[model samples]
Target: MIEILSPSRVDRARRTGALVGDILQTLRRRTEVGTNLLTLDRWTKELIEEAGATSCYVDYAPSFGRGPFGHHLCTGVNDAVLHGRPRDQVLADGDLLSLDLAVTLDGVAADAAISFVVGEARPAESVALVEVTERALAAGIAAAQPGARTGDISAAIGAVLTGAGYRVNTEFGGHGIGSTMHQDPHVANTGRPGRGYPLRPGLLLALEPWVMADTDQLVTDADGWTLRSATGCRTAHSEHTVAITEDGPEVLTLPRAA
Candidate 1:
């Protein structure tokens, strides 16, 4: 469903976005070599409960994923990219890590993701992967304005990834998000501009740009949820929930001082 949020709901969305951003930032700060994926999940749950917010993922049951995600956070390590179900894996120095999270507060929801290198070692390839995805996410957000088409956002993101020599995957990308974590108007990572759903004021979209270092193919892990690179190449993902407004696009999921 494509939802144009009410003004009051948009206000609530800001709160929800802030909560999601803050939690991700907090987790990033706490993460280090030896940190377990399951530990991150536990931290997410505690943070969500402390904020009096509900997790958008814990009980999420989507057709593509194993029913009931049963985890509050997605921790993707190295080659693992999307739908990364938290597990017992421990992060190592120089390992690329991606964290995707969503939550609802006051009846509104927000979603966002971030990728970075773990510990003190910053492998050049890992750093580049994270940086490119972040730039793509910024481009996507910049393209999201009132009257702009979703394809414009996709094209903007695609340019960055492709230009950086990374392969984009369209199977799982961004989407309309409001009261729920995922909604209509699927936003692919790459597409021709001037196509797809038209943007308008009050509409919310979660624009994510993700890429694999070598190939566009993906392979699901044995867990039936985590999506990894088919070629075992490192991957990175970046995302944010944006709201269309008269002033252009407002990034609701930007990190703020806590």
Candidate 2:
């Protein structure tokens, strides 16, 4: 469903967005070599509870994933990209980790994701992959505004990724998000400009741009959730929830200090 949030709800959304961003930022900072994925999940759970927020993932039972994800956050490491279920895995130096999080506070929800390299060693390829996704995410956000079509956001994101010599995947991408986590108006990572649903004020969109190093194909892990690169290539993902307004596009999920 496409939801036009009320101004009061938009205010609540801003709060929810800040909480999500702060938790993700804290998790990113605490993640390092030897850090367990489960630890990150626990941290997320505690923080969300402390803030009186509810997780959008723990009990999430989407058709594409295993019922009741049962995790507070998504932990995608290296080959793992999307829907990465937290497991008993420990981080290794130079490991590329991606964390995706969503939460609802006061009946409003916000979602965001971040990719970063762990430890002191940063591989050039890994760094490049992360940078490209971040840049693509920025482009997507820049294209979000009142009267702008969803394709405009997708096209802007695609231009950046394709220009960086990376393949694009459309199976799973950004979508409308509001009271619930995922909503209508599917936003692909790549598409033609001047197409798809038209944007409007009071609409919230989660613009995510993710890419694999080598191929566009994805293979689901045995866990029935985690999506990995078909070629086992390193991957990166970046996302943020944005609200279209009369003035311009306001990024709700920006880091607290940002």
Candidate 3:
């Protein structure tokens, strides 16, 4: 269901967005050479509880995933990309880690993700892959506005990724988010301009741009939740929740310092 958040909810959304962003930033900073996936999950759980917020993923049950995700956050490492369920894995130098988080505070929801390399081992290609997705995410956010269509955001993201020589995966992209985690107006990573749902005031969208290093194909891990690259190629993902406003698209998941 698509929800055009009421003004009061929008106010709460800003706070929710900040919370999600802060969580992601915290995870990014704490993730290091010896950090374990389970540790990250525990940290996330504690943070969300401390903030008096709810985790959108902990109990998320959809047809595509195993019921009751039972995790506080998604931790995709190296070749793993989306829906990365936390595991007993520990990080190594140069491991690319992606943290995706969604939370609801005061009945409003916000989602965000960040990709970073661990330790001093920053592979140039890995760095490039992360940069491209982050750039594409920025492009998608720039295209979000009250009269803009989903294609506008999709096209913007595709251009940045394809131009960087990475394959875009549309199987899972962005979507409308509000009081609920996922909603209508599916936003693909790549699409023609001027198509799909029209942006309207009060509409909240989560524009995520993710890419695989080699192929667009994906494979589900043994856990039946984490999405990994078919070729085991390194991957990266970036995302943010935005609110459509008469003034333009107000990024709800921006850092407080921004």
Candidate 4:
């Protein structure tokens, strides 16, 4: 389903987005070498509950996943990319970590993700991967304007990643998000501009750009949820929920102070 947030609801979406962004930022600050993935999940759950917000993932049962996610945050380590279910693994120095989160507050929902290197050691490759995805995400957001097609956003993201010498995966990308976490008008990471759903004022889209260092194929972990790189290459992902407005595109998921 494609949803467009009403003016009043868009206001609520700002709050929801701020909560999601703040939680992710807080988690990033708290993460360090030796931190367990499970610990991050617990921390996220506590923060979400404290904010009086509901998790969009804990009870999520999508066809691609085994059943209820049963986790508050997705913890992707190194080669792991999407749908990363938090486990007992401890993060090591230089470990590349990705955290994806979504939540609803006051009947509105927002989603976002961030990738970073753990500890003081930052591998050059990991830094490059994270930087490229962040740039790609910015491109995608810059393309999200009223009357612009979804493909424009996809193409903008794709251009940046491909130019950076990374492989883009279309299996899972961005999507329309509003009252729910995932919605229609599937936004692939790479596509031809001037195609797909047309953008309109009030439309909300979660534009994510993710890339694998080597291959485009993905392998699901034994947990039946976490998606990892088929070639065991490090990966990175960046995302944000944006709202189309009469003026242009407004990023709802910026840090509260932003």
Rate residue 171 of model 4 by lDDT. 84
| Model 4 accuracy (lDDT, Cα) | 0.94
lDDT of 1 by residue, 48-167 (tens): 999999999989999998869999998899999999999889999989999999999998899999999998897888888889999999999999989999999999999999998877
Candidate 1 backbone overlaps, count: 0
Residue 3's lDDT within candidate 1 is 96
Query: Which stretches of candidate 3 lie above 4 Å from their native place?
Result: none
Model 1, position 61: C-alpha lDDT score: 92
lDDT of 1 at 48: 98
The worst-scoring run of ten residues by lDDT in candidate 3 lies at 249-258
Residue 183 shift from truth in candidate 2, angstroms: 0.2
Off by over 4 Å in 1: none
lDDT (C-alpha) at residue 243 in model 4 = 94
For residues 64-171, what per-residue lDDT tens digits would candidate 2 score against the true structure?
987789999999999999999999999999999999999999999999999999999989999999999999998998899789899999999999999999999999
Local lDDT at 131 for model 1: 93
Instruction: Tell me, by lDDT, which candidate is best.
Output: 2
Enumerate clash totals for all models, in the order shown: 0, 0, 0, 0
lDDT of each: 0.93, 0.95, 0.91, 0.94
Model 4 agreement with the true structure over 119-215: per-residue lDDT tens digits: 9997999999999999999999999988889999999999999998888878899999999999998999999999999999889999999999999
